[model samples]
Target: MKLWGGRFLSKESKLMEDFNSSLSFDKKLYYEDIIGSIAHVKMLAKCNILTNEESKTIVNGLNSIMSDIKEGKLKIEGDYEDIHSFMEINLIKTVGEVGKKLHTARSRNDQVAVDMRLYSKYKALDVIDNLDIILGTIKILGNENAVIMPGYTHMQRAQVVTFKQHIMAYYSMLSRDKKRLTSAIEIMDENPLGCCALAGTTYDTDREFTTKELEFKKPVDNFMDGVSDRDYLLELLSAFSIIMMHFSRLSEELILWSTKEFNFIEISDEFSTGSSIMPQKRNPDAAELIRGKTGRVYGDLMSLLTTMKGIPLAYNKDMQEDKEPFFDAVDTVLKCIKIMNEMLGTLKIKKDNMHNAVKRGFLNATEAADYLVNKGMAFRDAHSVIGNIVITCEKKNKAIEELNLDELKSFSDLFEEDVYEFIDYENTISRGIKKEM
Candidate 1:
């Protein structure tokens, strides 16, 4: 029977059952759903709504069900409609009629509210730990490569830098994402259990009792807002979207670095794939997937925002749409982070290739101009002199440092013999490497 079948005269159609059922995805929250029930039963016992013996029976039944679930013995059934109903019906089967008494002072509205909050809380913690692993891997890679690389702007070499510095930039982005997850978790910590239906229940229930039992920071103050608010889900989606953007950017860099034209890095065999048709191909598939998943996380955020915008307040059925997107965003980000951390940990960096790229891009010209300006030449004149020198080098197809002193002097009298010292590839790399820090 449906949980609310007493009020409805007719059976729901198959189409309606298919549309209303959330058991497939929500079954993942089974542990949390049972935990919420245990907390609720204790509160009922305290309020005289359920006897102490009944509360003991419900808690024991919930614990046994949890054990069965962990052992893979419990199957979530479609006939139960949703996770809440499925767990409740199974509890009754295990603990007899007393299981029905567990819902004495509550409604499904608050039940789902608490379940989602608990699930989100733990998922955010998992994501934060995953980010920590990625961050630690990046820090190690950055420290190891801090002495070799050429940084670029507008897809052209702008300066010389260390691979470590490049990796640290992504580390900083991940750190900010961790902070966003932390803040979102803080906002989800409030308890929504006492707000039965859309108003405070008349059962003289001790909300504080359930709050303590569930380890919630405190009871939600407004009854209607408790069950109705999905701001926590929105906050989480927004955080996940930003994290996805970070992953996209990091993956984009990894993709570019892995290309032969750049050859700044290489993916390990375990992290890359060999083409079926090309024996020579080693593709950065993990990086590509991270880039692709960004679109999915973005879609989840936008879709949920749309679902929320047109709805009236105080708990509408439309709010049922919130869980799928929030769940999807969480799952997507977790997968991206997991793969990214592994890819980062195993990737092989080509410091020699990075050094070689500096040669092709004439990365030392700006540092040469800075050398002239520091030697008391006016900044504009120094720039003009360097600009002409670059043009001369381009025409002659030589690097700035390769030009004979006389050939450079032909462009500007500012070109002294010692100016070659400033235009050395190592000096350019020093500037690039320092800029990252």
Candidate 2:
């Protein structure tokens, strides 16, 4: 099963083989490996490198391997060097000697590069699909529950905003995340199959034929870059990191809102958990875990950056370090998206509590200043007057709205019966949204 044993007289030690083998994780690339191999085989035959009958025989063996592996007839695990070895080794064993020709113009370097690109290309699309689902769920929440709430600055109520505006902030972040992934896919869409180890082949290989057969956008122009470039992965990891950061922000708010003090929303019982000692616990474990996993995804990105930073040209064993972290990030973000979407769908929005919080926190304080400005008071003077009014209201244990006209006029002559309408939460949010238009 060792692919490079011609020059080696001594058998490889078990420990070294174990250390060097990537089949443990890269077996995840089995389907990609076989599919790329099929494309390469067909290209080889089309270019007359293999007889038509020989190409069919190798392809048949490759197809049989896929069926047997899927059906559990073949267990694709052992002391093989990697999935490429396991595959070509099995292909030869299955279809006799013709199976050896399947790798006629390919190198494991290009083979693995193509496999990883193929894997990332499709998985990125899956992540986008999940993002779309999450976006749809959030749009529904923002539309159905249009209640006004106190928007925060530095964790303190700063202004009036609707629950819709708050949730849609995440929608914006995830939408950009989807686009980042799409762009990364486009950048890595060139077919790298014929690059072959880095130097390419002397044989008259038709890379364009394989490119079209494999459904890539085009063939890679540089043999060295095709096998060596992992910029696509770094771009994708960066996108996934941004996504987790957005998830973490939303998760922090969800955890805070589910608490007794906030009482703004309730996570469903299915996503909740119990404490071992406290019988009254219904923890927002789903949101909490999502927040924690954000760090893990960040680490996945950093891990690859460190791994790829020092490695030099063409191909290196160091590149094998890339797959696990990349796969981990993909799995983490997908799970986070799925759970968050479900959690958002079943949430119980506490509109009354949200409204009460808005009122209690002087969310309309900014509106009071704007109200004075409308009455022709200088904005600076209105701001100072509102500051004093807030202090007095806090000392009196009263909201700004609770003060009567004479009490409000003591601070400023701009106060009137219409002040109530101007600072109403609904009117405040409406005016706030209108300013954007």
Question: Would you list the C-alpha lDDT of every candidate in the order shown?
Answer: 0.85, 0.92
lDDT of 1 by residue, 149-226 (tens): 677798777876667767788888889989988988887789999788888778889989888988988989888888
Model 1 stretches with alpha carbons more than 4 Å out: 407-418, 428-437
Clashing pairs in 2: none
User: What's the count of clashing pairs in each model shown?
Assistant: 5, 0
Q: List the residue pairs that clash in candidate 1.
A: 142-164, 145-164, 160-429, 160-432, 161-433
Q: Residues 215-254, candidate 2, lDDT per residue (tens digit)?
A: 9999899999999878899999999999999999999999
Clashes of 2: 0
- Model 1 lowest lDDT segment of ten: 428-437
Give the best candidate by lDDT. Answer: 2
TM-score, candidate 2, is: 0.98
